[model samples]
Target: MSNDKIKEDLPAILERYRDRIEATIKPYLSLNLTPDENLTWWQSKFAGREKSPGGFPYLPKGFDYPQTSDGEYLLLLAQINFAEVPYLEGFPTRGILQFYIADNDSYGFSNYYCELNYPQSNWRVIYFPEPDLNAENLITDFDFLPEKYWFETTELEITKCSAIRWTKKYAPICLEDDSAYKLLLPQIGEAVPFELEDLYEEFTDAYLKILDNDGWFCPLQMGGYSCYFSDDPRVGFSEEEDPFDTLLLKISLIESGSLFFYIQSSALAKCDFSKVLYAMA
Candidate 1:
């Protein structure tokens, strides 16, 4: 078929197969970035660098829950888990677990990685190696670009896939006491100089990479805890306030791809740190 014909027909085909498509895609999808062909291409850009920021081997800081001398929570890392399960014969097996820390003032480091054949019925557990940890290393800036298309294969079929692109900004966080540590910036890639519409296009393209590549069927989950001072007046009613609180956010996405249904579980802070903080829980 002509490229134009395929383009014109795709919308109708997608509409007609919407239900089936959803069933095929839902089980493998997750938030953040989907590593499709474009992601591979983007990664390739940094592949030849002798000092490339290690991508897969490094773990985000706070993942181990570092504590201060007084035993107080100092930093935390967000955890992301991804997996692929094939019910059909001949399909390739794949999975990953990654961690992230949005830029924060109190934290000093960050890291991410994946697990192969995670959550299997058996006892085997393989932890993927990560890049080296640099105390001065931070995600200085990031750009979530439009999706890119690529080709992939399952045991039963060969297909095209889409993926999202992101560029992160990193920098060193300097404290008042002159103790400095690296920090990931707070802004999303959407705030970059690109046009808003272009940004959305990039995001959609990247997201489609996950779907087209059958990314949605994998079982994936992400979560983390954060502590900071809250100014809620109710906390200071009787005496000098403690001036700090904790917040926790957890999310999980599970999909089967063939059935296209997914469950997203998200939990936010339910109480103050003085009561039932996540660090202690």
Candidate 2:
């Protein structure tokens, strides 16, 4: 409300991703979505309807096209409208963005885009992609979302420091002091290093040992780095930029480590996590 559009960088960032988003959508609208061995899958779904003359079949009617405007993408990915979908009773949609996200680049996407449900510190993806054909949602949604599932806290980094939550305008950054929201590194299911299904037992111990050496004494919250957001109305808002060069969010229009109020999630399930994950990945 003070000067030039605080979110000015958003447009440039979206343009950077525009081509990739467009490229990703090509297959979803055609037979390419079905494997050669399952031609029947495509035939059955489309039935007798022919693809559009442009060679691109749009998503089924009633489905929401992705929000492609510059800043719109930011709001779609980072902000949420709580009035839309009810939170799963135990997993509150609001929480700090912890950093324990699984970094598996072999797949070109994080294992999870996690947020710790406030007060409880339980982790989960609010908008699990509701895949039902028709692209479900936009490639941008898939491009922006973190992995889905809940990671309960095993410890907490209870620090006396004031609660911290930094929001970015068009970037995937926000910090939830590892002290409060909790972050659990991949030891088992959610994110197995090298996709090694057998490392959980040995890795979790080694991981914890490292934390202990770092002065970690939490009895419950645990995990690697994560992003956080504040639900506190008293929390002030700014328009700095996002910290960390997240592969997917690296094109952020926001500066690095700048905290603002715009990144808060209202806990809306308006996205299709499963589809986006599959496509974006």
Best by TM-score: 2
Which digits, one per residue and each the tens of the lDDT, describe model 2 over residues 1-281?
11111222324323443333222210000011111222211111111112111111123345443322222211111212222223322222432121111222211122322221222111112232222344443232223433322121122211111111222112111222221211222123334557654444443343333222211111111112223232322122122132211111111111221111112221212222211111110
Badly placed stretches (over 4 Å) of model 2 are 1-60, 70-281
Candidate 2: give its CA RMSD in angstroms: 22.9
| Top candidate, metric lDDT | 1
Look at candidate 1 and tell me the lDDT of residue 242.
29
Which ten contiguous residues of candidate 2 have the minimum total lDDT? 26-35
TM-score, prediction 1: 0.17
lDDT of 1 by residue, 8-84 (tens): 23343234433333332111212233323232211211111111122221234433332333433221122222222
TM-scores, all candidates, are 0.17, 0.18
Cα lDDT for residue 251, candidate 1: 24
